[model samples]
Target chain A: MDFFFEGYLLSHGNVIGFIAGTLTTISFLPQVYYVYRSKKTTDISLSMYLLFFFGVLTWLVYGLILGSPPIIFFNAITLLLSGAVLLAKLIY
Target chain B: MDFFFEGYLLSHGNVIGFIAGTLTTISFLPQVYYVYRSKKTTDISLSMYLLFFFGVLTWLVYGLILGSPPIIFFNAITLLLSGAVLLAKLIY
Candidate 1:
């Protein structure tokens, strides 16, 4: 019974993690779109995005080490999206 | 031997995760500083921060469910920082 309960909790935990990843990953979309449309990133911090880019990159490596496809996939998309924002901060 | 190697990899994975978490969490500092200093968030996306705020909040709850202090601690800080950004976006 205890094992069954643990498995149940673990499964739900994975579900929540999935949702959390999806939400946070896609959250960058609005910022990217806003920056692209406005062509303004003066208010955005270059250092923040730069650091975040590296952080996401590190997460990518972590995912590879863990052999977790979901982590790899989400972080990959996040890297691209955040990279776009970082580029906007640089160019615009 | 296999179990020992698995443990080693898992330990290293935890270390990497710690670093990744620290990096991503602190990355918000520059943006917060920039917004506070510039008093301009016109280019910062309201939707993005709004979504991110909730995402972090969910992570906090997820951490609690998982009974993981590191997850809770990091997400809590992220919640505060992202919340500040969201508030700034709304106010300025």
Candidate 2:
């Protein structure tokens, strides 16, 4: 019974973790698409995003050092997408 | 030798984790302040933050279940701040 309960918890944890990571990473897509379509970012707070971009970079490093796959993967994608938005804000 | 090395690694890990968690959570402040000042979210990506807000919610739950202070603390603050931004977006 204890073994079964442990297995259930582990599986549940993995599923929830995966979903949380995936949602957080992909959530940046709409902003990317919106900025792409609008060609304007006048209202976006540059400071907040610049800090967030760097924060994500640190997270990526932290994940690598800790050998956490979910953390690494999510931060990698988030960095790319957030980086793109930052670039778009810069360019147009 | 092993004990010294382990202590260094553990302390280093804690410091970096604290920095990362703190920066990520606090980085949202500027955006919050900006929105408060401008009363505008015309360029803010609603869908993106909406998903992100929920993702942070899931993260909070995951953190609680896993007994991770950094995750729980960061996400809790993030949710409140992000939630405020969302509410502001709705109100104004």
Candidate 3:
């Protein structure tokens, strides 16, 4: 879509930002999957996820205030993925 | 110092950003401490840290390009802390 390119694919900086965002965002998936399959979280730190969730949440709000789709999109995904890990840590 | 306030404490948004950055950056400390104390990393996902480290590195580069101190500062701390965890995961 034109909007996609304009939002995240236009400039080289934006492209680099997109890649950086994608790497960090998707990075959480393996952790989520790992915890889901193993159902073990003894080694995970509760405070880490707690702080991360809140931090990501704040970043989401920051994204909202800035009206940056990339920030909002990436942070939202990060929040969900990190939240999954946090939830797994709580449950298991 | 005037520079400190000007850099991170001037705008309300900047203050919020600083807090968010602090929360996420320091979040890794507990994990590092946990792994250090227990010397266990069975539950931690290797791919997650691998991706995260690179992602944070890219973010650091992005920060350098933007010449944003907050971005650079926060990401540098995150890189170190996450790297510590990744290192521990590799070792133990």
lDDT of 1 at B79: 94
- Give the winner by lDDT: 3
What is the clash count of model 3? 0
DockQ, every prediction:
0.54, 0.56, 0.45
User: How do these models rank on TM-score, best leading?
Assistant: 3, 2, 1
- Expressed as tens digits, the lDDT of each residue in B3-52 for candidate 1 is 54666656699788888888889999998988888889988888889888
User: Which 10 residues in a row give candidate 2 chain A its minimum summed lDDT?
Assistant: A1-10
Clashing pairs in 2: none
Per-residue lDDT of model 2, residues B1-92, tens digit only:
25646556555776766777777788789889989899998888888888989999989878866878889999999999888777777777
Per-residue lDDT of candidate 3, residues B1-92 (tens digit):
24545434334766677778898899999999999999999999999999999999989878876778998999999999999999999999
Off by over 4 Å in 2: A1-11, B1-11
- The candidate, 2 or 3, that scores higher on DockQ is 2
Poorest 10 consecutive residues of model 1 chain A by lDDT? A1-10
Q: Write the per-residue lDDT of candidate 3 for residues A9-53, one digit (tens) a residue.
A: 334776788889999999999999999999999999999999999
Given candidate 1, what's the lDDT at residue A51?
89
The C-alpha stretches of model 1 lying farther than 4 A from their native spots are A1-11, B1-11
For model 1 the TM-score comes to: 0.86
Q: Better model by DockQ, 1 or 3?
A: 1
